[model samples]
Target: MTPNALLLAHDKPAALRPDQLRQFQELGYLVLPGFLDRDLVARMRHEVDRWVDDGLRARSIDSVKDPEKFGVPPVMELELPAHGELITWSPLLEILDQLVGAPYAFHHLHSDRQAPDIPGKPWHHDYEHSTQTDRSATMIHALHYLDGLSTDTSSLVVLPGSHRERVDKTARAHLGTEPLPGEVVLEELPPGSTVVLHSALFHARRPRPGVLGKPRYFVDASYCEVGPLWPPVKPYWRYMLRRARELNLAPDRSELFTELTFAEYSRPA
Candidate 1:
């Protein structure tokens, strides 16, 4: 498919088209420009400011890094009303249902307000398989660019079809954020754009040096197809899942926050 084919316009139908599904299956990523409504974006941005400004983001990270010391976070990203809405947004869930093509479980959610001068991230993937054996099941990351991409902010560079390779997440880290032959640079998306990626697809953040840029409001949430027991990333993952269920984030989606979908939490070596 052509580069343009990878992106679906905001005004398009909420349901995933057969060709769009095929593109995701083949290319391992799909860009949804302006996928979110303006009102929702405004609310999420407000919550992001509160999340960062109030030190909630830091506390959440601390809990993950040193769970015994910090214990459970005072608040989770999903606890924020707007964030909860975004995570279980019906239209988005419907698309996920089509893409995963089976029952799936919520994996994790991260929210951030990145500085303009933040350094570029080396190429890496975030797929989680306890044994790292195969890619038989589907796992996806929904990268929500709340304020969207522009020349001021860093671009998202993704290597098409890389998920098919069964290598470590950092297999291409040595290459840093340098351009590669087949890499696609996404830098000009409108506000509230979202890019859904196959969790194993290699990607990087390419920052533009020497330019004054605005803060990039980003929120990413992942979900996995539910046949195998997936590894939980955070130490307090059980509590997080429990809180999500208590909040009824997705009342109609029964498997979304069930504890049976995950194995015990384990820190990375």
Candidate 2:
């Protein structure tokens, strides 16, 4: 089902209100359904298929740019080449402004995927792993479910209020470990739906049984305060990380994500 671009409403946009802000503060995560444009979502998914089949896309890196992120084939999230732009800017900025309560910075753009029965991303927080002290109140994590997500597919799982827990220091597991004893929730939503969260929160994406070989497509975006750019920062990275500018994954735009070392990209990449 394609969603009309005009249909994108304020409720789901990143810009939150008094109540929505409260919900995020308390629950750590909130669902804004039917907010993303379905057509754009479709294009992104198509591109993901092409990349997974091959390795290179206009904006993504196929080779291991960082040794820490080696052994990972990074052909996914073709949305940048397909969808010109604006898929991220609208709701993303609004919600971020409300969350950060200050102008934020762009950490970098990245992608993640999990096949059925395949282990998911290591459980952890984005900012904590990056080792950067972030000042932005919110971290913008806009996801385009190129392929629609469902319950069993082990889609993106997040601990709602886990953002509040303080874990200044964390451990890294050589192999996947069972989630700590407690209830777990996956933020399963349609294509084009974007999720913004505090960098301090705990979030992970898992695999789900799809129609056989199919997999999930998603984008990992991080935002924080604007200041001296992070080391290994790119030039275009500065101009594009603005609240006024729209957030689109156009292949034409540089810094949709620049290749960064592990120290450059968030940790555990």
Candidate 3:
């Protein structure tokens, strides 16, 4: 409806709320521009460049013009000790949990890039890997753009909450398949703002690719709960560690669960 109503998507559980979270279910995507600090953007861009150069030198590659096509594809793992200081400890994920009202874990980053003047990629849900149907099943994508991303240079096309529908084989084709039957919304965010979406929402990318070798850059990570953190739906267990170190829940979040991790949760699975 209004940008003011849209900003509330982040401040939920009390102060602010995401009217769009519900809207995304029906529309497929949302956008918030100029929502991040310039310094954070600069630091992220620098880290990305350093990671790319390191990969090139290590692999002795002449050029890495099309990493977004697929595979491990040379993306920087922002969690590495080297890049951790750049911007890891943001409380965004915790707030994200409150928004989704579910437990989720950090998924991988795409280390994405697209060449000059390329069309949008195939339309698909970001949760391409997971097969679970827990309504708690959702993904939060925090995309930080670098190098002046715009509607002309590039923008994300979403089918607004298309996650509810089953995957269409036609749209899964390699020829940059089209969006399903729904309105196409474009996200023209500034350099540092984040794009958060559910795991099921259908979204596509249109890359303008300014120069020949240059491409757009964005980072994505997903979150899941600790209860369903492991497989076979095993009881989530942990040791006497008072703190949760990414792999397990924090003591504050799961005190009894943490204590019962080894004793109770760790059954057969």
Candidate 4:
């Protein structure tokens, strides 16, 4: 399919349209072209470089890998001014508010500048439920491509309507990132584009072959509808929420930083 046709995944309406809403409900994803402002995207790119070059990214990973030892990183992605702004970006929240159909809590935020040679990630979903039961409640991830995508950068491949199937996050891991039937390859987005996905949607990152890839400035932040208590991915999730509140990232979004949205953090067995 043509890039423009593929982008029609979501209607380009100033406000979320009913048709767009229905698309998300049925397809489990929406692509918002140029969703973020260019200036904000530039700043986010700078922050991503710092996050990687200053060892902050390493520290953040250590906290997740061994929270008992690293506790929390000295900095979280949302603490960065532009990154924080992106989290509370009105347009994004508005679209999400419509899709979620209820108050939603901030799940987590991650920023990265993927190396040119980054390998393809196996197909996987990122939904965070304790039992992995139903898909009634929505958990959406706002995937921001700061510099946008092209043949030079890795593409995001997603299995359409896969979120409706109740299966383990890694059920498709063995399939790798190869093109699958009914899968959409997002390779031609403009700068500052954001592709929102139902967290349960199966997706993969496929790097370009032969051609030298460019550094991909990517950041993703997730939110969950307020119904059941969601599982916290970070052990320092409380601190993360507190820091977001202290920074006053989303003053009107009372549910955004609240602790009630999550159940107790359980160590992965």
Evaluated with TM-score, which candidate comes out highest?
Answer: 1
Off by over 4 Å in 2: 1-15, 57-79, 83-88, 128-138, 168-184, 207-213, 228-269
- TM-score, each model? 0.96, 0.65, 0.63, 0.95
Which rank order by lDDT, best down to worst?
A: 1, 4, 2, 3
Give lDDT tens digits, candidate 1, residues 94-193: 7898999999999999999999999999999999995566898999999999998999899999999998998988889999999999888899988999
Which is the leading candidate under lDDT? Answer: 1
| Candidates' RMSD to native | 1.6, 7.1, 8.2, 2.3
Compared to the true structure, candidate 2 yields what TM-score?
Answer: 0.65
Q: Per-residue CA lDDT of candidate 4, range 1-269, in tens?
A: 22322242223544766777887777888887777877888888899999999999999999998998988899989899998998898878878878888989999999999988899998999999856788888899989999888998999988879999889998999988877899889898888888899999999999888978789999999999898989898999999999999999999888889999799888888
Model 3 C-alpha lDDT per residue in residues 1-269, reported as the tens digit of each score: 22421442323332224564566555544455544546666766666666655663232122122223322223234434323432233445444655566544443344444444766667666543334355444555655565546555556666654667655423444646454575464545555556666656666676654444346666555444444443211111121122224433332444222332222332221
Model 4 C-alpha lDDT versus the unseen true structure = 0.86
True lDDT of residue 21, candidate 2: 74
Which scores better on TM-score, 1 or 2? 1
- Writing each residue's lDDT as its tens digit, candidate 2 over 1-269 gives 21211123644434456767786676566554555656656665665556555655433442234434443333223234553343335555566667666555556555545455666666666653344454333555554454546664655656667666655424332324345544255445565666556666666655543435445566556655543344432223323344213443433433334333113333232
Q: Assess the local accuracy of residue 147 in candidate 3 as a C-alpha lDDT between 0 and 100.
A: 54
By TM-score, highest first, what's the ranking? 1, 4, 2, 3
